[model samples]
Target: MQIYTVGGAVRDRLLGLSVKDRDHVVVGSTPEAMVALGYRPVGKDFPVFLHPESHEEYALARTERKTAKGYKGFVIHADPEVTLEQDLARRDLTINAIAEAENGQLIDPYHGLADIEARVFRHVSPAFSEDPVRILRVARFAARFTDFTLADETLTLMRQMVEEGEVDALVPERVWQELARGLMEAKPSRMFEVLRACGALQRILPELDQLFGVPQTAKYHPEVDTGLHIMLVIDYAAAQGFSLPIRFAALTHDLGKGTTPKDVLPRHIGHEERSVKLLQQVVKRMRVPNDCKDLGLVVARFHGKVHQVCEMRAATVLTFLQETDALRQPQRFKDFLSACEADARGRTGFEQQELPYFQLLLDILKLVQSVDAGAIAQAQTDPSRIKDAVFAARVHTMEQHYQFPLSQSVTGGSG
Candidate 1:
């Protein structure tokens, strides 16, 4: 049996990127033979094994046939007769179809090296249309390799797949998985752009897709387009190396703006409430994780209010903090602030501007936490009044802090 390093490991190495994991393809090897040699069986749908020593994944070279709809509808054939070229042909992109021999010889039956050098993404074969997940994968790759462009033929093929209703076949979990990964990439907007170009974005995320042409109030959003603003927000989140929840929040914070009445033109009054409702629909539809969904919900509901924090009264700010559960879950509150900061700095000419509200909120949170809630609760004669007392105490503390010299107290707050 001949083992060769394949797919991403080979592709990243050729591009001078840091390879994180290595996947191997074992040609001319059977499951029985692999077991006899000490490889542990791991794959459920295909012949895959874990190396006894390195614990890396090793799959027997195989060819697959499309047997039904969606990505799961594949018939696999793995035997001693399966060639390395045949296994390579099944990959989604030409750049990922390259393999490396044990002797350090590069195998490029599909001219993957040429495509990699040209910084382009091209389909391996006509079989690329068989898997709907490839559309997400190609879009994600565009986000990761920011400088790379999609080949015209590949884009056409992706568009054809979308038109054929391939993207709609993707499961919710799989769609979320790809979207979450794409959002974490260096330039996540590219992923959405590629999806939009291929018509897949409209199928998977119609709310986000509709935002592209929708105009926003020019004074508030210099970018003017609600969709472009969201893209800028997510890209800023990525550039800041923020966590997944923050990025997701940034992506969904403006969904309500997309549904604004054209009669209202650029104005999006009460879009925050609209955003919260739409975010819930998206969260449920995508089966988004609780952490991401929770954060997205708060950001969507209060992001507009958050942007106006500097002007809010002490009582209003305290109410906002209480409503968001920021006092109890400080980390999530910090993440919420981060998402809002991304939104603020996402506008054109605002990229490098400082967000004083971010640090201001943190300082307010610190001051609120400093309040002796236990003492205030114990002082309350009526148990029902305990929550009100604690809230009042926190608000009182914030009011007192506001009376101090701005620079003498919490670093960024205004008097």
Candidate 2:
């Protein structure tokens, strides 16, 4: 049996990129032979074994054919007679289909090496349509390799796949996995762009697609429509290398704008609250983890609350923290600020001016952190009085820096 490095590890190495994980394709091997050689069989749908000494995945080289709908409908055939070239032909992308021999000789049966050098994303074969997951994979690859562009034929095939309704057949788990990967990449805007071009965005994330053509009031958003705003925000967030929850929160923070009445003057007066509910539904449909869903909800719910809190006293900050569960996890306060920054950056002219509120919120957090732990503990006992004391302290600090009155009317007072 001969083992070779394949897929991303090989692709990244060719491009001088840091490879994350190394996967091996074992040719001329069977499950029985692998077990006899002390390899542990682990895969259920297909046969995959773990190296006895290395503990790394070593999948038997195999060929597959589409037997039904979706990605799981594949019929996998693994045999000692299957050539490595045959196995590579079934891969999704040309860049990923390239393999390396055990002696480090690179194999390029489909000219994947040329595509990689050209910084292009190309399908290995017409058989790319067999699995719906490739649609997501290509988008994710775009995100991961920001410098690469999809080949015209590849884009056409992706569009055809979307037109054929193949995207709808994909499971939520697979969709979310690709989405999470894209969000974690250094540049995710290209992912969304590819998705939009292929029409897959509307199928998987209609809430985001709804932003397209949705007009934003020119006075506040002069750059373009709400869709562009959201995309710009995602770009800025990705540029900052924000965490998964933070990046997702930034992307969906304004999703409610699509559902708001167009005739409304402000158009998005109470969108933060509405967005929280909409995001919950979207996350549920995507099958996101509970923690991520909760974080998204919290960021959406209080994303605009910082502006309202800017003029309030120290006690108001304390009450707001307690009511919103922000007090329970102090680090989340910083995360909220990061989300607000992304939101502000996504907005147009007037929206950009509102960044002061985010800065003010950050300043308030620092002020609160400066207070003695004993004082905060004492204030926590009586949640009712917490707002007043917190607001007062905040006002005292602000009076030293600005001309505005230290005290301002507090809304949602019960918190």
Count of backbone clashes for each model?
0, 12
Off by over 4 Å in 1: 404-415
lDDT of 2 at 175: 96
State the local distance difference test value for candidate 2. Answer: 0.79
Error of 2 at 288 (Å): 1.4
- Model 1 lDDT, residue 295, Cα: 97
lDDT of model 1, residue 287: 100
lDDT of 1 by residue, 69-134 (tens): 899999999989999999999999999999999999999999988999899999999999999999
On a 0 to 1 TM-score scale, where does candidate 1 land against the true structure?
0.96
